[model samples]
Target: MKKKRSNAWLYFFGALGGVLYGYDTGVISGAILYMKEELGLNAFTEGLVVSSILIGAIFGSGLSGRLTDRFGRRKAIMSAAVLFCIGGLGTALAPSTEYMVAFRIVLGLAVGCSTTIVPLYLSELAPKESRGALSSLNQLMITIGILLSYLINYAFSDAGAWRWMLGLALVPSIGLLIGIFFMPESPRWLLSKGKEEQARAVLSRMRGEKRVEEEAEEIKEAERQEQGGLKELLEPWVRPALIAGLGLAFLQQFIGTNTIIYYAPKTFTNVGFENSAAILGTVGIGTINVLMTLVAIRFIDRIGRKPLLLFGNAGMVISLIVLSLTNIFFGDTIEAAWTTVICLGVFIVVFAVSWGPIVWVMLPELFPLRVRGIGTGVSTLMLHTGNLIVTLSFPILLEKIGISSLFLCYAAIGIAAFLFVFFKVTETKGKSLEEIEQDLKDKHRGSLKTETRTAEQ
Candidate 1:
């Protein structure tokens, strides 16, 4: 009972980080209209402004692993909170577009770190029995953040109050910082740093005195087996796991989820809605995303990861195809606008319930302890790289190929993603980290022998 209480607090703090992430991402969509007018941003510059954070995210995600390893997840998250404050205030008060872009990159650093470290921290701290549900709190908090942002933005949308929209993130940043101050550090991280006594103390506080010693021993053994660097991740047997980690990461972004998310308002306008309705419609999309994420949190463990992935991908393909056909057939009529909105809402629902949470859950779980940090870093890098590609191209693609073609392209990628998940990915629901690692290694070795036998034949 005491352990459960302690874990509840840990998850509460971890979810705080997710709220900040959601706030940051969600704020921009609403703020962009006002920011563009105030900053006199042209279409090209608007795209740049919107995507600058993603560029910053690439570096942030790549570096966060090393920072977390050196500083510990607790401190790293605290540092990100500080960055969020700076970024949020800076962006809100920017004197010019250049300053806004620079501040956004700063915000991106925090966003990137939170995105990678929060889930990892939760996973490490959570008891194995509750890890899936607790780790998923990150997504739930994220959706809540989005929903909160949408509501905040809606309330403030009347007077072009984008500054407040951007600045509102400061509330959660402050909240997260304060909340984290009272939270315990991950025992796994403490053990990794040879702070075995400290690890036990934390575990005892969270898991009771009876279980602390055993749990500490398991964590210490796991840490002892870990290599903890980039070169260690390059071993031959690690390759398959790496590919799975990075491939899933890449697929999560490459399926064009962000095109809908970051550009929902503009995409809606392109279909035929007026600006007012488009902005209002985005709130609906945000709501669906939040609700479906709730569904995912509820069912991820119950139904398992693969079913959700397959279902989401299949659903997205159909939705995207319909979205494209709607655009092609109706050509910016109100009918097309409503169809696009409905289909896009479905797309958001499908994605939020599957890839949004599962990718984060699986990435850290799939790799063995030895190279988990490096493997996660590499995979996160791929995730951001894919994010950057879509972020940079989506606007340009919208201009060049038109909306129908863009959706068609995304639908095609969704099909590819479904195929990959079906054949390549393993079912990992309900497995412990060590067990999953062994399963991966066994499969890796078996595949290699088959390859050699075929070559010899």
Candidate 2:
């Protein structure tokens, strides 16, 4: 019950899911350099290979809620780990571009599953007192995983060992598979399934003896007050939450964040950095990303969500504007290269502290117990679908519209996202799930009143 075994270690293992996603993202940025030559890929084919994982992720997220609800979080995660191992190995050994694309899809499925499951799993398992910080381990490790991938990219650049770049993901995937074997199923999940005694035992260790029964009772009461499924999501009282959730998940991908994480190497090359310098620069960027995410995790509970989202978007808008101007004025000159790097660093720092972790934390928290699974799946599907669109389109955009034009577009999206948060999003800081739902209901009633007045007039 005391959990002398250390929940931190368990969380670390659980977050290996994030590590694989990061690794998959980072490896491709640099590997594409060699893969272009080996696979005879033009821009379109290369984009397909890189975006294949995102395509796979769409499927994974779409199905995650059903899988996790029916089979349990532990099993869903274990299934993902298996996919990671197979995908990592298959990708590294693929003899042709077509085979490589297939393998990346496999890896994408693993990433999608993790994105849907890991944060929710950690949130359900952690004590309320430390929920934000602990649940943030998913984002934290993802930054670490990206950093490791960049390091690998740099280390292998001279040797041209792109195969090793991808194959190494297998090591951690296997570790995740074994580590999951030890974790008890989520206590909240057990309670949802009516396995109260098993749920209490998990809670005794996750929280403590004094809190287990109380927390269990709270979950049961909340469940009693709610009705669930796809239909429930369309209710007037619930529509705002769904809109807010989907917006956060979707924009979080397109606010120009993944461009840096997924295409930093390519962007640098376009700006005149050599292959090795570009890869190393990516490592520096990845390091900044991880550090900022850590700082955000430390202060998120104290600072709350809405303020951070607003503040971070302000920084992103400014950075994207400066980068767009630089690219327009200097083109591929040396100064433009340096300016792009600095602006990207600023963008990643702000984004790391806010949207990256906050969105993931808010997703599971925003929904009621009855509809959490369906709601989570729907939003996650949108999140990855947005990711796929951005990833698939970036190369084509860069080629057709030019990088300056692309930066301007992202900057515009950033402004729109800021306005949405200001006008529409509610702050859920320090509120339990039930409390958040009540707040949303109050707003929903106001919305109905406004609609009624309009109709009567």
Candidate 3:
């Protein structure tokens, strides 16, 4: 009973990084609207400002695996919290575009590292039976962050307070820094680092004394096998998990999720809604995003990963197609405006329930204990890379191709995402992390033998 109460607090603080990730990313959607006037922005500079953090994130996530592996997850997350503080305060106070870009990159580093560490930390700490629901807390907080940003965007829309929107990230970041101090480091990480006594203590605190021994022994055995590095990531046995993690990461962003996240206000304005109306529309979409993510957190364990993903991909594809038709045929009418909002709502709804949570949840589950940190980091790198590409190009693409055509392209990508999930992704709904890793090893061995037999024949 005591452990249960403590864990709820632990998950809340540990996943607070997602709120910062969501807010920093989502605030830009509204902030950029007001920013264009004061900054003397063009498309190129706009993309640069929006994507600089992504650039920083690329490096942050690339290095975080080693950082978390070497220094420990709790410390890595604490460092991210500090970086978030610096970035938030700096970006809000910047006098010019160059300074703002530099600060945003700093924030991006925090975002990158947190995204990798938070889910990894949560998954390791959670029991297998509730891992999906517990891990989904990260996504749930992210949607809440995005929703909060949208509300703030609306509140300050008339005043044009973009700086405040960008700066408010400091509040939760500070909260995370304080809250994390009271939380335990991941037991698996402790065990892997040869801190078995500490690991057992953490597990005892988290899982109760009776369950700690079995779980500790399991982690110890897995840790004894190999220490994962870049080379291990490329080895045959780890490749499938690697592919699945990377694929989901790529498709999650490439399907145009972050474009809406980072540019919904701009997109709505382009569709002929007034500026206030545009930001308000995004608030509605943000609301749906939060609500549906709750639905996902409710059923991710029961419904399984692949089904939710396939359903979401199909829904997103249809929503984008409908959105495209509305933009092309209606062309800025009142009818077109409402239709666009509804389509986006549907898109957000399905996305929050499926791709949004599942990608983060699955990345940690896909790899073995040895490679989990690096695997998650590499996958997050791909996620941010896709995000950077889409976000940096969105305004330019919107200008050249227009919203109707852009959404159609997204719809096409959604199709590819659906097919990829159907073909390449596996179900990890109820299996223990060790069980899944063992399954991968078994499949690899079976494939090697089949190849040998075929070659001899």
Instruction: Give the TM-score of each candidate.
Output: 0.95, 0.96, 0.98
Per-candidate clashes, comma-separated: 1, 0, 0
Model 1: pairs clashing at backbone N, Cα or C within 3 Å: 226-370
TM-score of 2: 0.96
What is the alpha-carbon lDDT for the whole of candidate 3? 0.92
lDDT of 1 by residue, 1-457 (tens): 7657767877888878889888887777777867787899877788888888877777888888888877888998999899999999999899999998999899889878888788888888777666777788898888888878877777787788988989989999999988888877778778888788888888877777998877777766666765667776777667767878888999998998877767887887777666667778889988898888888888888888889999999999999999898888878577887888889998998999999888888887877775665567678878888887887788788999999998899899999999999987888888877677767667768998999999999
Range of the 10 consecutive residues with the lowest summed lDDT in candidate 1 = 219-228
For lDDT, the strongest prediction is 3
Sort all candidates by TM-score, best to worst.
3, 2, 1
For model 3, residues 237-317, the per-residue Cα lDDT tens digits are: 999999999999999999999999888888888877889999998899889999999999999999999999999999999
- Estimate candidate 2's alpha-carbon lDDT, on a 0 to 1 scale: 0.88
lDDT of 3 at 421: 96
lDDT of each: 0.83, 0.88, 0.92
- Backbone clash pairs for candidate 3 read none
Model 2, 234-345: lDDT tens digits are 8878888899989999999888788788899999999898999999999999999899999999998888889999999999999999999998988878899999999999
The alpha-carbon lDDT assigned to residue 220 of candidate 1 equals 69
* Candidate 3 local Cα displacement, residue 228, angstroms: 2.0
Model 1 regions more than 4 Å off:
1-3, 444-457
Q: How far off is residue 446 in model 2, in Å? A: 5.8
